[model samples]
Target: MTSATRIATLVAALGAAVALGGAAHAAQGEGVSEVSVSGHLPTQVTVPLAGKDRTVVRHEVRLAAGFVCRNAVTNRDLEFSDLNWCSQRSRVRAMRRYDGMVARGMLTAEAPVIVLSAR
Candidate 1:
């Protein structure tokens, strides 16, 4: 075979390999849907009044935030391997809830905020 023909064949093989590699990579990701922030429902808490035995029921407030990966076909949540996948917006929302809980006297300001995925 001529040198020019050999080079051409090699180039074609490389191109085909790259295309197949990309297709395989895409196929591997086919099961995963777009990433999204997980939803959390608020819970009511009963707290005793300071210096008194009386307790009161506080309003509902969210206590955590999380990231969720779902299946593209079924829309069901799938396990994620890393906490880094959680978005900044989700973290900020959790902080807001924590602050609200403190402001409403449901929690103390020194309480730690919870991350659902981290737990």
Candidate 2:
């Protein structure tokens, strides 16, 4: 094959590999645990990522009815919206009722806007 053809093929393959790698990361990314943040929520959270691979600081949170978490860094109040209520949600209750903002994901917002779902 010509050198130009070979180079083009290599570039295409490299691009494909990079795309697939990103897709895998998206698939492997940590999912939001079925939980909510307590009232007067936290402004920051220290999330342990990838099987204790590393820790990340997250800000901005979504507090549901029964969230039992807090950020050791910033003490920001969480305003919750909507969330999935499960049968095993015996721990979540009122008093901790937040703004009910319908959301999911980490107790903080260092990452993208993610919401949790049972399905």
**Best TM-score among the predictions, by candidate number:** 1
lDDT of 2 by residue, 1-115 (tens): 9999999999999999999999989887677466875654332222222222111211212232123332211233322321223211311322122223123333343332223
Write down the TM-score of every candidate. Answer: 0.28, 0.27
lDDT of 1: 0.44
CA lDDT of 70 in candidate 1? 20
lDDT of each: 0.44, 0.35
Q: Rate residue 117 of model 1 by lDDT.
A: 33
Summarize candidate 1's per-residue lDDT along 1-119 as a digit string, tens digits: 99999999999999999999999999999898899885533221222223321122111111223322122112323234433343333445545655575578765444333332322
